[model samples]
Target: MRTNALSTLSFWNTPRIGVARMQSDMAQANQEIVTGRYADVGLALGSRTGLAVGLRQKSAELAALRDSNNAASLRLGTSQAVLKQIQDGADATLTALTGVPEDKRAGVLKDMAANRLGTLTALLNTSAGGQYVFGGTRTAAAPMSTYATSPASPAKTAVDAAFRAAFGLSQDSAGVSAITEGDMAAFLDGPAFQGLFAEASWGTTWSAAGTAPLTNQISLSETVETSASANAPALRKLAMAYVMASELGSANLSAAAQGVLTTRVAGLLGEASKGLITLQADLGRSQAAIAAANTRLESQASLLDAQIMDMEGVDRAEAKTRVDRLSTQVQISYALTAQLRQLSLVNYL
Candidate 1:
């Protein structure tokens, strides 16, 4: 190694090097004391660094699953709540129609069915974290189109066409009073019934749909079907009932005619109520699975936390001791450096 010829320059370099080393050591000790983890992370882990890395990765994986589980749980809960609302709505309409005078049944029944249809549409279009629950991978858009003049609302158009085809006139035709249950049943079972339900005319109103339901992986090799499609049978039944009740509202039907319509609609709503039971149960299963996954992930996270602590954590008492020792050493090094600076050839003389 080449040497500096001047002794003063050499003396200056030595003290600076000593002070720098002491400062580095002191900083490391201070960091360990403040952080509760070894300052020399890489060196401390050494050959075990890979294990610690794997443990941390596992922790992160569990955390990700927990976050997904939280969102999924809420989504499942929302679905269940909506199902209850539908069931209760159907029940209320049925009870009201049964108790009302036959002469006043049409208006009361129409309002109830119309309300049910709108509520169900809103529920089906609900999204979890911005993803539509019933859209079957078409998360960006609502699952149902409104029953209006819009071309996309084939369900509404079909229902209107159905009324014309069945009565040979508008739904408000006074001749509607002459109709029978057979006529209502025919319409209910016919292709014209598609107009009131997006699921019935899925491609037009509820586009990007499929039979395969939405899902999420709850655990390794365990996945859950998260939500049912908009075309669920129960929904279809409700839509049919709602459409009939709504379109029949303006019809100047007689007492017998009102009884036939309301009675048929009440029966259909009852069936829809029954069908929703299965859907609610299915959604509950998904919610339960998410809860179970959350529990397992929490246990796994605790273990990972322990592993990480063993790999990197420092005892607080030990760390404080180390910081105190390094601080004393640093003070001694400063004193020695100052003493050495005074020992030049001229100072010796």
Candidate 2:
């Protein structure tokens, strides 16, 4: 007859092993319950893990796009506000020019235009989030230069030189009184003088902005220009109007010359106001487009969240149940192991 012998050491090790495995299962279940996700996404998703990873990556990209779009929207809104201020200033100046008596026009309009030009320069050089908002693609630096002479402003110097070359006399010279309305008109409208606000000359002196505005990716499929350049025709015209009204020695000009200068300034201001309104409309459209893109992004994000949850998220109730059962099994295994350890030869004696 053959007899089977049970090893006490093997008996002691068996329940200890079972308890260790049950504790590990309990820890896994507890984690799943706490996090509401599978403890190991790859292990749970297996062959479809790549799909989950791709979806999560795409979702992250969408989130990034939405964040950037929000920033672009803010910048656009700020730009629009500044544009409104500039338009208002232009309108107000035109009103003052037309309404003020002829004798008072030069002094009042000159002082007002100078102050407004400074304000406009400050506005164009406005910064948001450490970036100059009106700098087109050149956001790191101020887009507009101050209209001043002390620091030898490039724009001021250029205008002064152009005036001297055209009339063979400085702006403040008494010879300005001799300039016929025809000469003033020719200089203001001709290539020689109008060229100062042309794209090349404006870029060379008045503006540091690029011709192309800054663009933003509002969504996976959509991109929009989110900035304006100081060198845009509307802004250039406004600056030119201010410079002519304030810096051309308008106060000393004969009444006939003043009339020509004021008429040109009024025309430029009107054109600038119209162009600025058009710009605002374009930005308004961009804002609408960005808002629509964000809506689509939110919907896509929600769907992706649902799909990711299906792949990686766990059932909290089921995980809690598993934790409870594992806890009981581990407790029983521990008790049995303790009882086995207490089984001594002295107890059998």
lDDT tens digits, residues 1-349, model 2? 9999987899899998888888888889989988888998899989999999999999999999999988998899999999999999999999998898766677777888999899999999988888888999999989888877588799888888999998998888887988988989999998977999999999988888888888998989888888888888999999989988998746668888888888888899999999999888888888999999999999999999999998899999999999889888888888898899888888889
TM-score of each: 0.85, 0.90
Candidate 1 residues lying further than 4 Å off, grouped into runs, are: 1-6, 148-153, 178-181, 194-200, 206-211, 254-256, 343-349
**In candidate 1, which residue pairs clash?**
155-195, 155-196, 156-195
lDDT against true structure, model 2: 0.89
List the global CA lDDT of all models. Answer: 0.75, 0.89
RMSD of each: 3.4, 2.5
The 10-residue segment of model 1 with minimum total lDDT is 198-207
